[model samples]
Target: MPISSDHRQYWQTNLRYLAILLTVWFLVSFGCGILFVDALNHYRIGGAKLGFWFAQQGSIYVFVLLIFIYVYLMNRLDTKHGVNE
Candidate 1:
């Protein structure tokens, strides 16, 4: 069966959200943790180097936060698409 425009748009929006969230995760985990580690090291967080913190803990925290954000976003999207339980 053919897909309806609304369904296609819904999936597109979902993919866009996933792309954006994953990009953010990548930047935080790789950018701050590796690429900018030296620069970030200039700052301190909780007595630890900012970059080190990101590499060791910050990425995990951000990932968890992103999961929550994704859940909230998906809930809204589901409601908007009339697919919510």
Candidate 2:
């Protein structure tokens, strides 16, 4: 049997969110932590340079934050789509 339109829409919305979040995660993890490390190093984060902090700590923090945000957003999406549990 074919999937319903609502199910398809839910999956599409989820994929869109995943793409956006992954892009942001990548930019924060790789861009700020490495590619733009020199520029970010100009700033300080407590005892360490900003870039080093981002590479070692900030990326992890951002990833965790993104995970929570994804959960919250998905919950809201589920309610909006009448699929909440």
Candidate 3:
């Protein structure tokens, strides 16, 4: 069976969301944690180096937050696409 235009658009939007979220995750986990570590290290968070924090804990926190954001976004997307339960 052929896919409808709505289905194609819905999947496209979903992929866009995934791409954006994953990019943010990568920037936080790898960019800040490694690439920009020296620059981020100049700052401090609760007495811990910002870069170190990102490398150790910040990425995990951001990932969890992103999960929640994704859930919320997908819920809205599902409703918009009439796919929600």
List the candidate 3 regions with Cα displacement exceeding 4 Å.
Answer: none
lDDT, candidate 1, 1-85, per-residue tens: 9999999999999999999999999999999999999999999999999999999999999999999999999999999999999
Expressed as tens digits, the lDDT of each residue in 1-85 for candidate 3 is 9999999999999999999999999999999999999999999998999999999999999999999999999999999999999
Candidate 2 residue 31 C-alpha distance from true site, Å: 0.7
Off by over 4 Å in 1: none
Error of 2 at 60 (Å): 0.3
Tell me which residue pairs clash in candidate 3.
none
Cα lDDT, all candidates: 0.99, 0.96, 0.98
Residue 81, model 1: Cα distance from true site in angstroms = 0.8
Tens digits of per-residue lDDT for model 2 on 1-85? Answer: 9999999999999999999999999999999999999999999989899999999999999999999999998999999999899
Rank by TM-score (best first): 1, 3, 2
Clashes of each: 0, 0, 0
Candidate closer to the true structure by lDDT (higher is better), 2 or 3: 3
- Model 1: how far residue 35 lies from native, Å: 0.5
